[model samples]
Target: MTETQRPLLEVQGLCKQFPGVRALHQVNFDVIPGEVLALVGENGAGKSTLMKILAGVQPPDEGQILIDGQPVSLANVNQAMDQGIALIHQELNLAGNLSVAANIYLGREPKRFGLIDSRAIRSASAQHLQAVGLQVSPDTLVGDLSIGRQQMVEIAKALSIDTRILIMDEPTSSLSQGEVERLFDVVRSLRDRGVSIIYISHRLAEIEELADRVAVLRDGENAGLLEKDQITHDAMVSRMVGRDVSRFYQRTSTPPTIDSDATPILKVTDLVVPDHPQHKVSFEIHAGEIVGMAGLVGAGRTELLRCLFGVTPPVDGDIQIDGTYTPIHHPIDAIKAGLGLVPEDRKEQGLVIDFAVEPNVSLASLKAHAWLGIWIDRQREQVEAAEGIKDLRIKTPSADQIVRYLSGGNQQKVVLSKWLVMNPKLLLLDEPTRGIDIGAKEEIYRLMESLAESGMAILFVSSEMEEVISLSDRVLVMHEGHLTGQVSGGDINEASIMNLATGIQAVS
Candidate 1:
């Protein structure tokens, strides 16, 4: 914000264009030494494109990058690093087979007598490792370290390259609460030592806690900029979405009711998973209701869903649908019993990236397309796939286009389409919008509302607190493999959720 002095990093008139998208247009920003500039925007808002350009992952169509008041060309990642700029991706780029010291000095190991100097590497690695507050030995295997520790090693690797500016993209998305706190300490220490940082994340709370200036982008343009004092949840949301977000999560329908005559569509009684048999959990979701399961990272929320979907069979439990006990011992059994589960990792569990859109849509319901109990009915498959594409508003070149070619949002829609055709009585979503754009998130929320209105029972698990609190009609809080409490109406705030998730009795 101190503009009288020349900024350490400056971007001017940046533009990036894809085949069908103008990713960025005349975008400009600057960061002073030791300042944390938070780049925020909805998905598809050009944030990633700009970051990629800065990191030399790709060339910008038009732009000027100034480092220390001198124009420079970041022709490649190495060139950027030579200019004292380093990028730490969300997915750590450490080699699991290598040792910590080897990873830190992978390509640039010191040489002695025409051989790699092991002592020199360990000694230097120790200094950088201590700079990031990591206490692990330099010889520790990178794979054996925890995710949080791996992230620290990444920072040490960057510092080893004489980095003056650091760009972190979603650094803490996979970290636990304790890990996040430790990471924040490292960021603060680095900032104090005069390393300018450009932090990009969807979590506004992180930006508020760490950033000195907030830059917001919308639809590939500069929406607004906020100084430290001006950054608030409402301000950021409004600028990111290009509208007032007072009612962003407002419900369209009234709260669902369950009277004495109404039978629950999805019921779990005394469920016990193999991992934690001592904790007995129970919950019931009625037709036309959307129930949200809220908990911390290890609070058994996803485990419960896995048990319900038969991904991990329950050790002991009674699952009933429409007042009849239904035994689900495997994924196929759950599918046959009119249940659909969208796993947390879409790329890993929910999708086959090598397949085409039409085939992916019909993957879960192939039984309906089977002919004579042997051959597939291609024509019928295409018809249903086309119908699903139209209903889901999936943007693709054609049904034959590979699903891997689609955007993250479109890929998720394809995953949903696969199960939607089966007309499952109960739908379970685990982190449905995990890595998608904000626009896609809003679309998914609307879709969930529509499905619940049409009498489908919906239960979803989310790590994001705001999402669970705003989207659910009722929230079930879990703690350490147990159902801690239920929150509804006036008791759905973060305080209450965190209280119940940490094993404290909720006041409500």
Candidate 2:
């Protein structure tokens, strides 16, 4: 509010550089003691780099960090933590093999008589978890818990520390609506108690709900900061991309016109995964149609997609392509059958970060670039990669640029390009636009529309209700692993989807 109420955390002249790129450029930002300051930008805009510098994961090439108005140098993570700075990265870093309590109080476990006090640690962890409104047992294994619970554990771990500043990077990306509400409550309580939070999220709605001030970054520089009242979604989008972006989910009004009696490209009858036996899913995707899968988190939307892609074997189901039933036992089998899956977790499941963009896009179609004696044709590979990069509008220095260096949206495009190279008859896209900026999201939506227009059968899965309603010709809603209802045309709005997803109506 005033200089007298100076921010508890001040960053000035922050600069970071990699081999061929300047990741961050003289970035300056501040966070008040009792307010949520949102750090937002497009992928590779240096948001993560700046946060990493603050967390001591990376040292800034040139910068001054003032904590409580006193200059401090953080050489490593321990030093950062000792200075009361805690960072929760986008990727969960918990020890899956350990108990939640163990993971929470990992290095700073309570000791009694020169021995680890397991009971004390568990009790403290439980209390911190409860403070965050998470109802998970301390003894539960981290891997055994859902992604949402694992995220809660991460937050609880941060709270267990004597943290003056908490940095959360996309904290609610994987959370359901209910879980997000609980997280917001915890964040509010923490803010009232004088904890400075640097909230980073792509969801503009969440920023409006949680952030007191918003700092925008673009192309490794500070664009500007907006007060809560002045920040609108449109303004934020423009700031992030340096241009005004229109409606992100722009779908055509033309109805899908697949031949009514045309043979089904993909037919799944009584699909049931072992983990989800209750879901007796049956669906048919016609060639040249984009079929939308709409539902809430844990509504078996992703699970169904996985089953269709053979990520997991379905216990009782028959998959037929072009009127011929085929048994798919693994992803390889599915791919051979002209089916491609763009998994939900693009970073983990879709792309190999350490590899270059060319390799990633060509990974699934290596055979196409192979020569005599199983030797890879480097020239052919480059040609294919270049085509994909241009077609997908992937922003990279070149196809040789590592995917790890690309932005989130670019990485997603690479994943899509990878599958597109396979020339699949059926393409399964799960939450394709998650964590991407509005401009990039619109580009992806356009690509999907174009692909469907090209006579490719696409099964689109998205958590955004508006996306589902606008993009899909037919919407199938699932609840607790069961296909509860299907809506076509105008009936695919939020209310109808919610009603079906919550089991308020029967499938027709």
Q: How would you encode candidate 2's per-residue C-alpha lDDT over 113-143 as one tens digit per residue?
A: 9999999998999899898888889999999
RMSD of 1: 3.3
Per-residue lDDT for 142-193 in model 1, tens only? 9999888999999999999998999998898778899999999999999999
- Candidate 2 residues lying further than 4 Å off, grouped into runs, are 1-4, 135-137, 506-508
List per-prediction Cα lDDT, in the order shown. Answer: 0.87, 0.87
For candidate 1, give the lDDT of residue 414.
92
Model 1 spans > 4 angstroms off: 1-4, 96-98, 107-116, 143-146, 261-263, 323-325, 354-359, 370-410, 436-438, 505-508
* Model 2's TM-score against the true structure: 0.96
